[model samples]
Target: MPQSNTPVRDRLEEILARLDARRDRERAYVKLYTESARAEADAADRRRQGGATLGPLDGKVVSIKDLFDVAGEPTLAGSIIRRNAPPATKDALVVKRLRDAGAVILGKTHMTEFAFTAVGLNPHYPVPGNATDENLIPGGSSSGAGVSAVEDTCDIAIGSDTGGSIRIPAALNGIVGFKPTASRIPLDGAFPLSPSLDSVGPLARTVTDCMLADAVMAGDPMASVVARPIAGLRIGVPQGRLLNDLAPEIAKAFADSLDRLARAGARIIDCRIDDLMERLWGATRIGSIAGLEASRIHADWLSDDAALADERVKGPLRRRLAVPDEAVAALLETRRALAVEMDERLSPYDLLALPTTPIAAVPIASVETDANEYDRVEGLLLRNCQVANQFDLTAITLPMPGQTRPAGLMLMGRNGADRMVMEAALSLEALLRNS
Candidate 1:
């Protein structure tokens, strides 16, 4: 198929064109389930020419992470275990919404098996190119979603964020990723990884793209707010322990970003939230509730189809077996307490800033084969962002393109205050561009 001549499609169409080209070059898709997608896109084009339009995203091509159901396609989720799983009889809620809004479903993108890991290395399928660097890890479990967007194959790539699955890949691949309040988006028809932590969002080229995807996924109307200036905005930067553990390149880029934001008139404040490390450690020790829920959700498959599971995915899946009942209870209590704690802390500021990930993309080869290396990648990948998920807060990662290794300036807000966080993010995005 030739690229669209209509410039109105912008980011969405450009990506679909590139995706088509790359599929021929790198052989990325396992199913390439797009027979319906082409028909949908053509229908959208006819609507446009006939003076009918859905919204700003009308007629754009979108790629769903394989974990999501697309009516007739199987939800592979980059696993061999469900290779013979029956096709979905209906589209996932988010998928149906996109179709209603004029988005052409561009089939499913690949990911880590059952989305167990942060690095996007799937043994069951070929690894998609990381766009910036061919050899580096794409940052998973949303690996191909980010790949599809970064390579311009899809304007918006939907992904579920469970411990940084969406943001990690987006950060590594230089795209915008939003991890919204956990319960905001419906997880009705998607495959479960850690249900408690799995909030689906998108990886896109710009903040606008992320916002558009977020609206559709949350089933909210798309509304645009003018980018509020960052001048006099209270933005806190935590130091001491939380910011102490970072790679030199990441630290330098973070420091530079702060200086730039401050110069652009943001009220950059130095502060430390009490029990920062202790709270995070407690959350981990409590055995991620999502992990346990994932196990429960997939109990039948895990028991009957255990042998067919990917070896790399099994290690993380096993950890769920060890989540003590008492620990799960304790974690739930801590989540409530921590929410109160964070609310008190963030009450004084518009947003808290942090580096999305401490290091850039690691090599794909090492991350795929060695379990220890996989752990390292997971740790660094989810370190900063997962904190927001644990507390049920909202956060966004804004790309910092000038850095040697691509990094993101993260903005975090209190639970249920996603709108405020996104407003601050949009302001910060403008501040970053000017600076």
Candidate 2:
């Protein structure tokens, strides 16, 4: 394994120090489980000092989503509904993988309730402020995961993306966020919101960090992705409606990104995706499979105290229950058809590129309380990302260079094309930086 000159303790301590500085009223973590984290890090350093080194992530700290099972820690899933649920009997599969790789578990990060809403707003717990601007909403469900990664609270922050939860926050917060093909990373012990679309991935400072985290979560040995130039890449962009709603700043950044890639010898093709809105609706319609499953898991709690749940959360969940069986079946069929079409359309190129979100981060306070605005902004926030989940594709959102407000350039690929997607992403990363 490659070794670093920096001491493990010093590196881990630097990340933890940033976490300490973030202590405040609007912090996301309700209970950090800091004692357990410190113990794990200390043990890792001691093992290293004793000349018994382990995996590549020997002392790296990763933040777990509140939804994952951490031995002896309650799996809140970002709601009070399961507050009384018993402590997890064991760490979830991903957690086990992290442990096996010698990564220190740095406690839980807050998220949208039941991981449903894209906007990162939870009335019950403090919302983590977007790193770039305190006033901006950390595009979420996986809100804190992105913030923690960007703020250096952890080397990697794990999150589940159903409809852009992972990519959204990463875009707003200015970091690399990846949503692998749903089955690429196991979700055995994580809470489910949309079974069909739900996928576990990470938000990190660099694509290299995401690569490392991806390997650990998948129970594979760590490996490095040698950065390649963007020369000869066939980059596709869906024109018309998909690119219509972007803000002026996002449009400029995207155009600049294209110019850089083209200069690097990439062929930028204007691709058109028909029935995109229908596909988006179908994906969202089928998304209720999770709510149905989750509702079953929380049936007792919902019946016993539905009123105690966050009102905003109840709206999304209740809507799922109201969806007719026939409608769901129809949506499932639509999903199958769309998936087939996506594969045919995307197979010709190595990857497709677009603006990650139609707009940049919205004001945090407004997102927290205004349901109508939240729905609109959240839809816009997730528009581009939903396409990947809709067709079961893998995608990465890289923060484009330049621009103070923060925006992302999305690179997408067919389902199960994770390695190819990563290769394209690393190439684009270099192109954007050197441009």
Candidate with top lDDT is 2
For 123-231, candidate 2 gives per-residue lDDT tens digits of 7787777878878888788988888888777788999998899999999999999999998999898988777778999899888788878878877655566665678
Q: Best TM-score goes to which candidate?
A: 2
Give the range where candidate 2 is weakest over 10 consecutive residues by summed lDDT: 297-306
Clashing pairs in 1: 15-152, 15-153, 120-140, 194-290
Candidates' C-alpha lDDT: 0.77, 0.80
Q: Write the per-residue lDDT of candidate 1 for residues 25-92, one digit (tens) a residue.
A: 65344555455666777777778788888876677778888888867667877777776889999989
TM-score per model over all chains? 0.91, 0.92
TM-score of 2: 0.92
Q: What are the RMSD figures for all models against the true structure?
A: 2.9, 2.6
- As for candidate 2, its clashing pairs are none
Regions more than 4 Å wrong, model 1: 1-28, 274-277, 303-306, 322-326
